[model samples]
Target: MADRLVPSISLKDFENRKGEITKQLLDAAETAGFLTLVDHGITVDEIEKQFALSKAFFDLPAKVKSKTPHDTKSNNGWEYKAQLRPSTGTYDQKESLWLQRGSQWPSDEDVPHFKDTTTEFLDKCAKVSNQVLSCLAIALNLPDDHFRVANDPNKPDCLTQLRLIHYPASENAVGTWRAGSHTDIGILTLLFQREGEDGLEICPGRESHSSFAMGDVFTPLPAHTGPIVVNIGDMLMAWSDDRLKSNFHRVRAKDVGKSPSRYSIAYFNQGRRDFVLQGPLKKYPPVTVEEYFNQAVQRNFARQQAATA
Candidate 1:
């Protein structure tokens, strides 16, 4: 089959259109497991502005950018060519800054208004994520607030992650990957991609439950549209009893020789660390958010080590 586009749903009349949007989202989530969202309230200009800010930070001298230093415990700060994935047994060809609570950030003098603007955009993204989560709750025959209650930011325990990634331009050599194949580790991931900087591809799963493996055929998703690409994540899949798919995706280095630098942003919507997550179907044992994250990280690293060995 030819390359396909992931379903693009709108939040134009969110309250009134909730049912319509929910069905589309639910169908996509169950099958293809990926989709792009439009009318999400973030303007093109605002997204572009954030992209420019991302570029500014990445353009800073190596020492300046490295000052904040990525912390594994907090999972925040800057790292370059550091994410080695299990699928390819190689470091991802990118540098990224991960932002979350208690993160040590660059000074405002270094990047004027960076923190203020990024935080503001994060709020907008969170709002969109909550709307989707609420709809998914309804689709799953649960209370509309089921997901939101766990992810409420005002509860003082809610924690989320926002990452800015810069994939430098380089030779499109064989055996290299911009971002190796992997599934996201949260409830949902809202991704903002630079227009026409396409390399993203997904291999939609067709099975009873989620597992990681390399697949031959994949579909290319366009990075040209204004909509933010949203993918169902592992936590959501578990919560939905594997009814929601968490497909594998990657950024291939295939045309990098003709491509420019790629900058992307992702907002990972997660719940409080202490929230006990148990789906109504109980396909998996109940686990706290904090415990789940640690388990997922360990599984990934073990797989990577085994692959390399």
Candidate 2:
């Protein structure tokens, strides 16, 4: 089989033909299960500024960074080592700050333009997410805004988690070790590469070796700087009756001297917790929120056990 590439859309073209663009997006999702977006309308300056702030935050002493610990409730604020473990059971060797779009949006009253800049970026991201959701609906042969009905505007808990992650370089790092191997538990994920270093890999599926077979393994397509890599997650896969795929991906530890640690900003487009996660449309049986939640818990537990053993 040939390597599959996702669709790429320029910013100007995306605005001009929203309908056609959405169609193309659906096509990519149905076929490749992922796509790289270009001209996403986010400016280079803004990207740089955000990265700089992330670097400054990470550079601070661990004690200072730990001031705002990760809270299970808001899921907003900072997290240190061991505070967050991957669903796969391994502890990610990085520290991160999670930001969300809500009443809890960080206050920048003292800092000049901080609030405005962050909010502007977030708003644009949300618009992009909306476009993506519309395309997902069309791909699933449902109404354009089918997913939106689940999100109640009055309750501001629709989580759009923006995670800024920084991994420190280690001298004895093994090249093939992983940050974690697991599928995301959301609708879609939008990731930005803040640094030039490459370690992220998307595994399409596991490959088996046979007597007549070569040692070929499924691997990730290398991503460029300007394009945003989009991948399907668990909720979307379930909703689509397995029409779309929830890809498994991981980050390998890089050589200490060969490359500096990696930095990335990932925006998770998630639905509100209160919303039931039934399969949309009449093609599949309906499932309740509680059922879905229990399944997720079990899946995580299994992954963790497998990882540890």
Best by lDDT: 1
* C-alpha lDDT of candidate 2 relative to the true structure: 0.65
Best by TM-score: 1
In candidate 2, which residue pairs get closer than 3 Å at backbone N, Cα or C atoms, i.e. clash?
A: none
What are the TM-scores, per candidate, against the unseen true structure?
0.95, 0.82
Model 1 CA deviation exceeding 4 Å by range:
1-5, 206-210
Segments of candidate 2 deviating more than 4 angstroms = 1-3, 83-89, 102-114, 149-155, 205-218, 221-223, 255-257, 281-285, 288-294
Please state the error at residue 52 of candidate 2 in Å: 1.5
Per-residue lDDT of model 2, residues 1-309, tens digit only: 223555565545755677777777777666556777777777777777776677777777776666656776666777765533343355777778888765343334322455576667677677767777776787677887877655322247575577888877766666644466666777788887854667777655322100112122435555345567788777777777766767667777764444467888787777776666656544445655345545675666565667577
lDDT of 1 by residue, 1-309 (tens): 212448888999999998999998999899878988889899999999889889989999999998879998888899999999888888998999998755787778888989888878988988999999999999999899989898876565676888999999875544367898888888889999988888888888645334775467888786864788899888888888988888889997665355567888999887889999878888789999888888888888889889899
lDDT of 1: 0.84
